[model samples]
Target: MTDTALVVGGTRFIGRHTVSDLLANGYDVGMLNRGNHENPFADDGRVTHIEGDRTDERDLRAAKLSTEPDVVIDCVAYHPRDVETAVDVFGDVDGYVYVSSGSSYAEEAIPKREGETPLRPCTPEQATDESGETYGNRKAEGDRVAFAAAEAGVNAMAVRPCVVYGPHDYTERLDYWIDRVLTHDRVVVPGDGQNLWHRAYVEDVASALRTVAERGEPGAAYNVGDRRALTLAETVETVAEAAGTECEAVPASADALAAGGLDPDDFPLYREYPHLLDTCALAALGWESTPVDEAMARTVADHRESDRDGNEWDPGRDAEERVLGVKETL
Candidate 1:
């Protein structure tokens, strides 16, 4: 059981949390990445960090030989070219937990229920060579290649989280709205305030990834999202309440937000999907969501406490004090 768990691109927001969870849960963790950001586990000597590029074949091959992990939890993979690189490097590994996305679901055309349809089924070389337009498409294509390789040989499982939010999130997606509602008392939305959004805490997502690495059945796909699908307005209100303050949240037009450089990136808040996810399957595996109210409060607290010298989130500065992205002003 001490065999190492290789985390590819494990320096990102979700990757950090998952690495922590893996370490805490008794796995010998090893991170493989380009050494871009500050090392999240700088203090911990229990795990090894292999600085390399997953997209690069030589780098990945060297990492595979060095770590020789039992499980490979991919945290960054976009193109099939990346998948090709990974499989070429690690010909045989225990479990391959691909960090795929729930966006693989074709929610625009069909309501995505678990097993409702095979997720991003294998496509021909010409047909699947390109992707990554939307969150769903990129994730779907990535998952397609990963699952196909797993089918060939390798214990592979995928988890599609609705919207992952926690400390140090890349893209600063959730913090934007949460900070706006809690601090600025202004919530922006497009078209209708009623358009819904779904989100999951980073810790919960991390734990789910760990669980899959530990006990996930091979080639299985699990949706790790909360059932609490709240509309944008309601989510704002809930965030405000969790912030322990009564504030005004004025919904600005989409044009205003876009002009203000508030264009939604990773988690588009105003996307219209009645049901973002049915995460019952993840829960069935004994993976639970940190309560809505609790997670919300923690997010708010972390945001507030993250204020360092009143300049909490300037990317130009170098510091591990905020080893994550902060879009406090939204």
Candidate 2:
């Protein structure tokens, strides 16, 4: 009956923001990570941080049993194996919340609805594989782990978030667009540039997570995304307008791709037209996104002031040209 929560990847991106929100909300918080990045929070003493790798068995044993937590929210899992390790270690914890990705569903066929969603497939065996890693496929595996582990004995819930951004954002994917627009320079778009991208703010995501840990229905997965939708072109134009500047977007070119450090052959950008997530699934948890204008301004200010050096980002999440599939040179 201890009132405590453990968060993995508590110093980076979504994890860091979730920790801050948890502290503000008066929950006893413990953060688990490898301590590879800068610490984002001041020592409030209410929050305890344990540094270690999620992939390490020693760390897992320590994370689950050391706290005897009331709830555990994992923020750093990419493979399902990581999930099994957590379940094994947290023998008899009360509540569990695993942050999964919406990409756990096939990019080509997720219905944009409120009542339910079709989950992508994953095998039980891969759920514990140490070497499997791909965004969508691995997430599918991780989902199985969280879902199955939740079914075994704990009050468990999974939250799937898409395209999270905000102040302290590490990759500055939004920053790339904002920077180019602020410079009054053309931002690059891959093709017809009409693909929609789902958006979620980091703090809002954290709030949803905390709520999920407390009130979310066990053995269920909720899509935590916003109704607000933006196509690549629309966002570029909107940002340019907001920045009080005029810029243009050109179709990405092979030479431009090569110059931007893409092979123009292997890592082709492949964005599907995105759909709005059915956040009604999360409405019961009292989740909400920050206002777009305010979020944008805050992000602009952070990057301008360099207050987000330690934010987490994927390999090329910042590059506007990712998903274009730049084929590797033979």
Candidate 3:
């Protein structure tokens, strides 16, 4: 009587964690992907690998026939057409969850809610464009596609996550901060150190996907994040605490950052405006997020075990040091 689940992109980041969560919850899992990345669950008896390209409809159809999944978690649909194709292919599944983003919200609200917030409108050009500039538009359109599919009797849902971070996070966004806390005694923080950016732990997002698939209302979108959104300063402190270290968070103003020949955006996880999401809807599905402290601890442990210094995200210590010196004189 075990439920069968198929993850479209199961070898990386959020998709990777989703596969693990489903398996732990007594579901037989199958992964359909291009097999470009190494499969962590390759040898596991409970997991199956269905090699295919998600962008190819023939491949998706083949995977559906091979797995006969009760639920489908799509992690790689980037365009509206992708969702349209998926809905056509897996419309018969018990639940079809599309991975959406908080960026899909059109307006700047304190806390973006699922139904109340306005979703960005996607133009025909944006729908087909593969650039990051049109990502929000594309995601919003994908959500609309899912809703339309649900209206047609497909159990399609969407889960929007802002800034997801944890083990195997290829984005390396949070890894930059973890690297700073581990290597530097003084970490340069933007503005008042209270810049808030809601982030979801990878495991929490994974669980949210499953929960939404199981108990979520058809055509509804759910936001996922830690119940307690941490400020930039608090996040640094948490990372330091989790790493068992003492590091000072040095606050830098816009002028100070410019003096150092850098901008606020140069710092990873720093946002000019607060970007928050209301996860109460997801929580109502009997899902809970991991405590920030516990999440940071696991992230730090994974960072310590890897070689990701997040240098791509770092503007350079010399520049940050100049900013610190400017702050000291101020």
All candidates: CA RMSD (Å): 7.3, 5.9, 0.7
Report the C-alpha lDDT of model 3 over 243-295, residue by residue, as the tens digit.
Answer: 99999999888888998899999988889899999999999899999998999
* Per-model CA lDDT versus the true structure: 0.68, 0.69, 0.95
lDDT of 2: 0.69
TM-score of each: 0.80, 0.79, 0.99
Model 1 has how many clashing residue pairs?
2
- Stronger candidate by lDDT (1 vs 2): 2
* lDDT, candidate 2, 243-282, per-residue tens: 6678785556556555556432222222655555777878
Model 1 TM-score is 0.80
Give the residue spans of candidate 3 off by over 4 A: none
List clash counts for every candidate, in order: 2, 18, 0
Higher lDDT: candidate 2 or 3?
Answer: 3
Off by over 4 Å in 2: 110-117, 123-133, 241-270, 307-330
Rank list by lDDT? 3, 2, 1
- Rank by TM-score, descending? 3, 1, 2
